[model samples]
Target: MPELLDPRNDFLFKRIFGSEENRDVLLTFLNRTFMEANKPLLSEIILLNPYTDKDSPTDKQSIMDVRARTTEGELINVEMQLFNRYDMEKRTLFYWSKLYTSQLVEAQSYSTLQRCVTINIVNFKLLKNEQYHNVFHLREDRTGIELTDDIEIHFLELPKLDAGSISLQQGGLANWLLFLQGATPDQWEVLTMNEPKLKKAMTTLEFLSQDREARMRYEARQKFLHDQASLMEAAKNAEIYGFKSGVEEGVKQGIEQGIEQGIEQGIQQGREEEKKQTALRLLRLGLAVSAIAEATGLSEEDVHSLSQSLE
Candidate 1:
């Protein structure tokens, strides 16, 4: 095994858990996931879009996720996201709606629509909680009554998975997530021993890791993911810097303008106060109010008020 491929890298994830030969692998993972969520488990999952050599990086529309249907006819889409686009909430809703609505066709009754579930395995932290997995559905706000069972969404933020705290006795989901996170050979040996189904997933990864062509495609996909992450990160950093610079510049200009206005008002007020004092002195010396008003540049009303203050 030449450095086992990371299953979180969507392409390798398809090879490990989305291939027809690895159907059991996907089934086990799904069961574990549902068990953790306290939802009903599936007996079998039919893979509609399995991995193929023709799944090129250029033709990605169909090969983007592991599309499956359960024996109960519920549609399920599982995707591995290597980077956070910062729109996971709305993006997940958009994709879920697409999947839910895609089930209907022209002249088809709304009754024909099956329950659709979307599982997003994101590499970055998505939820504020420390828990690694969460599920959502349409429900009444005050009452806990569910509108329907036709829509379901799950988010498994891999970065929040606590490897040390995971106990195989508790569940197999933790083990499966760790395997996807690219567990070391030694770690897999222990994890696989506890979860028998993970053996196939590990074996698939090992077989695919050494294939020269697969490695080439994997590297291409890896490069694209990394480049996309870098580009998004650069854009986010630039936006923050731009906002900070704009705020600082605005504050600096506002402070300077405020100081200038304050100084101008102070000078005007001081000149007016001097005029009032001169008018008072001249008035007390028996000069007429009109002459004092003219000499001091004070309005007649102002001079009158000063004279009243004197009296």
Candidate 2:
């Protein structure tokens, strides 16, 4: 028996939880996520884009998310993201906007827009907080008052789950996330007992894992994910390196030119402090406003402002 497939692989996820055949799995998972968050549990859900054989990873164009609609007309999108897309927040907003706006075709009232909820089950960490689950909504920044319930987004950061702490305290959400995180055999038994449909979900993974062609596609998908993560990390490192180099070069050039012009205090007293010290000294030296601006890398307006006081 081959090892069970990981549910976090979006393709495998769609296989187990995105099809009408496994609508129970998707319902339980969504219910657990909402229940744990103290949000309303969905009595029933309809998959707007149910899965089919063409969803296999062999087809590069397969949709990666499980889109559904609650019985109450609320739009829900559940996506399994195995990499930290740095733009997750903005990406979520874009989708939420699309779903919310797509509700009204033409001449429809603004009140016709149904609530759009985007639930992202992400493998890597994105939020700074320790909680594995974070829900966001438009609210007053300081007063903490929600302006509307029209747009809701959930970010389930898998990395933030503390393995030691989640015995059963949070219940179904923890179990489902653990299943996605790859539960051990013993843990799998406990989880299945906790959620009846989970056993079927596990069975789906087992069946997929043993099939030769399915195994091949899963492997290919895993390789693609690994390559994608590597590319994102490399790009992030390059961006950071470029930023530091630019800052160092700019500061070094300004300091070198200041020192060469015989300004005694080229020692940076921090950026703003350094600017003030250099500007004051150049001002005291009776240099022209333009000359001081050139020496300190400040605009003429800035030099004039610095020349006024605090010398």
Query: Using Cα atoms with residue i matched to residue i, what is each candidate's TM-score against the true structure?
Result: 0.86, 0.78
The alpha-carbon deviation from the true structure for residue 206 of candidate 2, after best TM-score superposition, in angstroms, is 0.5
Model 2 Cα lDDT, one tens digit per residue, 13-84: 888899899998899899988887799899999999898766657454438788999999999999889878
lDDT values for all models: 0.87, 0.84
Residue-wise lDDT of candidate 1 within 171-267, one digit each (tens)?
Answer: 4789889887778878877887768888888777788889998888898888878887898899999999999999999999999999999999999
Candidate 1 ranges with C-alpha deviation above 4 Å: 58-63, 106-111, 169-171, 281-297
How accurate locally is residue 56 in candidate 2, as Cα lDDT from 0 to 100? Answer: 55
Error of 2 at 20 (Å): 1.3
Best by TM-score: 1
Count the clashes in each prediction: 0, 0
Estimate the Cα RMSD of every predicted model relative to the unseen true structure.
2.9, 11.3
Positional deviation of residue 154's Cα in model 2 after best superposition, in angstroms: 1.2
